[model samples]
Target: MATLDLSAHLKEAKKHGPQARGISDMARSLVGSEILRIAGEVKAFAAQGNKVLDLTVGDFSSKEFPIPQPLEEGIIRALKAGHSNYPPASGVIECREAVRQMFERRLGLGYPVGSVLIAGGARPMIAGIYYALCSPGDKVVYSLPSWNNNHYCTLVGAEKIEVPTRPESQFFPRAEDLAPHLGQARLLCLNSPQNPTGTVIDRDALSQVCELVLAENKRRQQAGSPPLYLMYDQVYWMLTFGGVTHHTPVSLYPEMAAYTIFVDGISKAFASTGLRVGWAVGPTDVIERMSAILTHLGAWAPRPEQIATAELLNNGPAVDSYLAQMNRNLFTRLGKLSGAIEALKGKGWNVDCISPQGAIYLSLKIDLRGKKTAEGKLLRSDEDTRKYLLEEAGIALVPFLCFGLAEDTGWFRASVGAVSLADCDSFQARLTGALEKLS
Candidate 1:
């Protein structure tokens, strides 16, 4: 072969305007998050000096809801004590031990410290699990209107089987819905109290799911195929409201320990998303492989944060107090918005809202489709309804399409993470005006 003329090729390529940048086929096939795109529009609108109640982002506003005081103090102390070095590829020993204890104490699930892998956040842990277990074109099952499962499936080159959850079940997948797909799936991704929908799987439903998974794993083993694994994303487990209890597969059925990998962290429970700490707990072999994958990717959680998190998880009183207060604050905002939407529905507005269930999200339905605006714009799709609400009500919310739902699913997720009680209180009048103007 002739020697490559690298410099000549570079010079010629530069002459043809800006050279086209190349991305992997996988990267090129992925679509960006519509939630973030809507958030960008909200930012631009706010930049014009208009007051907008932005509920698009699933993030805590430090002013409205701060991270646990103990966690914050512990982080400060860790930094002061010179915990700036790199952490173990898996995690600091103390942090892993703390995670072990936390799961055992809180959820009655016992995984050895060796089975826990820490990473920058739940995203990395999730990606690592996908990378570790899934082969190209392997089937991965999840529910639609979920958070990031589709994107993860795309990233791993797995065939996605998105089960459409029904509203009657609070938009959570039933065992029957998922049973049909389990035989062919290598990974089943689940989240509860789910992002976007704020729903939790009922105990009975979850028990059945665990049974199905166990059965599938047995069949796979008999057939000499790789076992199906469940990636349980329970980041919002602690945020369940009212009498709703969060359930995990391993907790209900101990046998699930062999096939379930938990993706959890302080991102939601403690409102520490920016702290960049999360973990995965699973079978030792799977976790070891995931740890190796994450190690090569260099996605370890920060040393100081990990050290601080260890202290915080072990602080029972502080964790309990913070969770109670956080739940109260979140519920107040969700309740207010849900009630306001119900009131509007009573007044003949084509709007409805599910009662706040678990997470800091309220499921809102604004069926403004086929309605004509004052400016003669027809509200056709969920996007149209989203824009109408944003422009006319000065209220920003994320449509279900952002969460991988169909364009016509008139549903939206109003995240209360960044909004305050006062912000929710103001939503009614603005929303009423917007609805009135629509007709």
Candidate 2:
């Protein structure tokens, strides 16, 4: 029998740190699209006429809600004009300039052109910031029941500290909870008009958080620690449904602009998910580093897409008409869904939900342990109810389990964004029927 020298091979493997070991470790720790997978299966079942009334993913259904007409035409023209080559790595100058202008005009914040980088979506923008700012074993703080990608802290070799929020406080992390962690935190992730739960962080809450972040960063610097970084995932920036005033972290704290990275794009507001485009704004150094990283990953976003996007922004009237219609369409659906959830509480389900001020989702609570129908049947976990709803009542919902939640809970997320206002009524009916049947 021949014995191989394993130690020599292991030493050779360790030499490829940044390229192989680091990134591979990052990949392994990151969570994949668990919700999307369930959503896909339900969609397949629906297509097969299984009577699946899916509420699993956040997608806007094609109904009276129309895609922006001008952007579509602009894209066609750009493609026909032969603008198919690789664009500048940072992003096209025109798009970057538009982004800077939008920030100033809309949010009242100013960012220089060199401070922006365009990516496929907010996810890539997040990944770029993590790569640029976090080191192995650094701590990153965020709130729970958040977008599961907060798990990416581990991917960047950073520790994830979750500030568990309460229902009474609207599930937002308070500054007091964050202050203790600031000394060790390398990054903080804030998602406004949050995914799953459509709770928009109130302006006052943001103001308090900004003050805490700055004060704590100053303390940490005095103690000779690295400054804490802030990644604001404002993907639903322009998707406010009700009369809520949207707040930007960068706008709230310009001093923290050096540490703050803002993620935004056209996916939610413009319904352009298939376009695979988004942009980030941060410090010049941070943008430069992330752009280099993106270049190594992919040369650049398609040139035609950038040109088309610029045209859409530069043309005011067409975009305004689209935005107006979209706001009306979204609010109509969200109002219907909120009313449905509120009505369920009277049925002994004891469900509680917050009306979404922005974005498409409304996170609802079902007291699994206490839930009972007038008929006296017990309600179990969200997954069990979801299955019963799908198989028996023809309704589909993404269970809380898919969002990295603990067991024995009665929370689930439904998207009111994709479905039309009329379909949302049907969805509510289907859901009501399922709840009634369970009892």
Candidate 3:
């Protein structure tokens, strides 16, 4: 049977009438990921057969950084065993128990399995958290340069209380800075071994923030208002380095457990992004609410991957061995990039980077604003700086502006996930020649 060609009608509909506002207000207003948009451009640039070292997406190149061997084997085994059915909305019971046991064994935070709700990676958990907790116009306090808090707030129609952080504090919000925002906010978000910046919050600083949360909850109790919730996205908690340790609110103060929800997954920690297994650990009531939200969206992890991840996380020795090797490889990659950037700084270039502490990123500042390119065009913004580097040096990076930074900050995130140490070393040679053309 011949199908009617509807493309012309659909195109005409878009030019006038209700099709202009056909999408729901929320869907229409939602802004897509800038990080992803830039990553797409980088991919297109590389597809042209250019010698570009892409450091855009916080994603692993499976060739260089494969998922743990045990996890891979388990996935194959599970698939062979016919574990292909839809998993329970909350996840497989075994996997939830495994996450609970792993957290207790590894992070020293013990909780019943019911508090854990599994989803298709951590993104669903974040969206579920926003959907579960926030009403329109409620305040959500998150740090600047945070991963996706702004987008989440917009999705849920929450008021954003942006806490701008300085480089001195590693782009982490101080307790004092967060205190004023938390009093009336519905949610407070924190990330450690933080994305984009690769900075870890010290124990003392984290403790103070925990204390602030506790105090805020107390005020809420007296005022007969709902208690504030804290969503601690520790997806990169396992990726710390350089003698810095990762700390958690609940780990510091057990009282904060009532208000703190931990979002974690194998995606970042185990280099298993494609596995689609992650869990939220928090109060049972909140987890249930989040579960309801996710269930409607069908956001549970795949059964085979969940079963395989359970097997992986439950084995302490395997997890330890994988992390040890993983950290060494990541350390080497980060060291190459950091050394090259620092060398440029030493040569009096307006460039700098925070020493890598954790995560697959290094906070690099290519502060070339106001400088004219060799083509006699002035670099006016981070986008200009990004394009200049890509066109000149063939080095691709994601600017911090993509990470909710609303200014012309020179900061960019250099993720060492998709490239090799050799690819990283190439940045210095490429960048040094590129910078020479600047006035």
Highest TM-score against the true fold, candidate: 3
RMSD in angstroms, all models? 4.2, 6.3, 1.4
Task: List pairs with backbone clashes in candidate 1.
Answer: none
- The predicted structure with the larger lDDT, 2 or 3, is 3
On residues 28-59, what C-alpha lDDT tens digit does candidate 1 reach at each position? Answer: 78988788889999999999988899989899
TM-score (all chains, Cα) for each model? 0.95, 0.88, 0.97
Instruction: Please report the TM-score between candidate 1 and the true structure.
Output: 0.95
- Sorting all predicted structures by TM-score, with the top scorer first, yields 3, 1, 2
Candidate 2 residue-wise lDDT, 1-439, digit = tens: 9988799888898887746665665566566687877877677778877866566767665555455777778778989998888888899898888788878877888788998888776778888988889888888888777786566776677787878776566667888878888877888888888887777899888988999888887887798877888889888878886788788776777797978998888788888776767899998998999999888888365777777777787777776778877878777876776788788776656677777777777777654454554456565667656656676567667765676555545667777656655677775677776666554
Cα RMSD, model 2: 6.3
The stretch of ten residues in a row with the least summed lDDT in candidate 3 is: 17-26
- lDDT comparing candidate 3 with the true structure: 0.91
Off by over 4 Å in 3: 1-4, 17-19
**Which consecutive 10 residues in model 1 have the weakest lDDT in total?**
14-23
| Candidate number with the higher lDDT (1 or 2) | 1
